[model samples]
Target: MKNLVLGVNDAIYRACIGVAGLAIVIMALIIPWGVFSRYALGQGLGWPEPIAILLMVLFTFVGAAASYRAGAHMAVNALSDRLPPQVQPFLTLFVRLAMAAISLFMLVWGYKLCVATWNQYLSTLTWLRVGLSYAPIPLGGFITLLFVLEQLLYGDQHKRRVVDYECTEDSKEAV
Candidate 1:
């Protein structure tokens, strides 16, 4: 059962990484094309900037979830580290609970925001619904919530091979 859950998470994590990577790659191509078309070709394109912005949003939210699962998200542990050993577990629990709360907030409020804006469309990209632009928020929140639950149930996955590829590679090299 544990292996099944971890395997599922591993697939999800890989998908997140791929999505974020694709968004970045497309944005990189789109931005340069936009610049080149505007300056060199003497005709500005309307789609690139908005598309890039949307991709950035996707990258940010999705990448954030991936980072969290991998324990790569920014966290200042100075205060926690200085605390007594016995208090550390409590602090860890507190942090996880706090993350769960934040994830829930994002899921609920973001879905509300998306629904509220569903009827509207982006002015620059007439076919694209404004709500669609906000989809990543709830999606990312849900993904992160899954990861948090996994942590609460199974313990920290930071050392997992899927999450820490570099460490795995180093260990392989040592062997």
Candidate 2:
């Protein structure tokens, strides 16, 4: 079960990163193209701005899922590191479960928002609905929740053992 969750999450992470990177590349290329065309040729690349904004939105949320899988999200690890050796495991578990809960909640709520926005067409492009732009919310949240759950179940077992001062000969100072 753990492997299954990790496999799917990692797959999604890789795909999302690739798509988001492509979106950025497209935006970068198109913006310059639009500017150069308008200024040099006197004809506007009218589609670029709208397309760039759409891609930018995709990049933000897709990249967020990649960050979550890579454990690149912002966190304060200081307290966890300071925890006593015997308590570290529990602390780690707690943190993972907390993250999973939050991700799950977001997944549920984001799906609702996506559904609500489904029928509304984008202002700039009537052919494309706003739901298409916002679909990443539920998708990213689901991927993140899966990854965190996988880590909690399988990752902790593989962690390197840490030695603390209390477990070493330095503890003799108290006696």
* The best candidate in terms of TM-score: 1
Worst 10 residues of 1 by lDDT: 161-170
What are the per-residue Cα lDDT tens digits for candidate 2 across 75-151?
Answer: 79899889899998888788888888888887898899888999998776778888777777777778777667667
Clashing pairs in 1: none
Runs of candidate 1 with Cα error greater than 4 angstroms are 162-175
lDDT of each: 0.92, 0.75
Which runs in model 2 stand beyond 4 Å of their true positions? 1-5, 43-46, 156-175
Worst 10 residues of 2 by lDDT: 157-166
For all candidates, the clash counts are 0, 0
What is candidate 1's lDDT per residue for 49-145, written digit by digit as tens?
A: 9999999999998999999999999999999999999999999999998999999899999999999999999999999999999999999998999
lDDT of 2: 0.75
Clashing pairs in 2: none
Q: Cα RMSD (Å) per model?
A: 4.5, 9.1
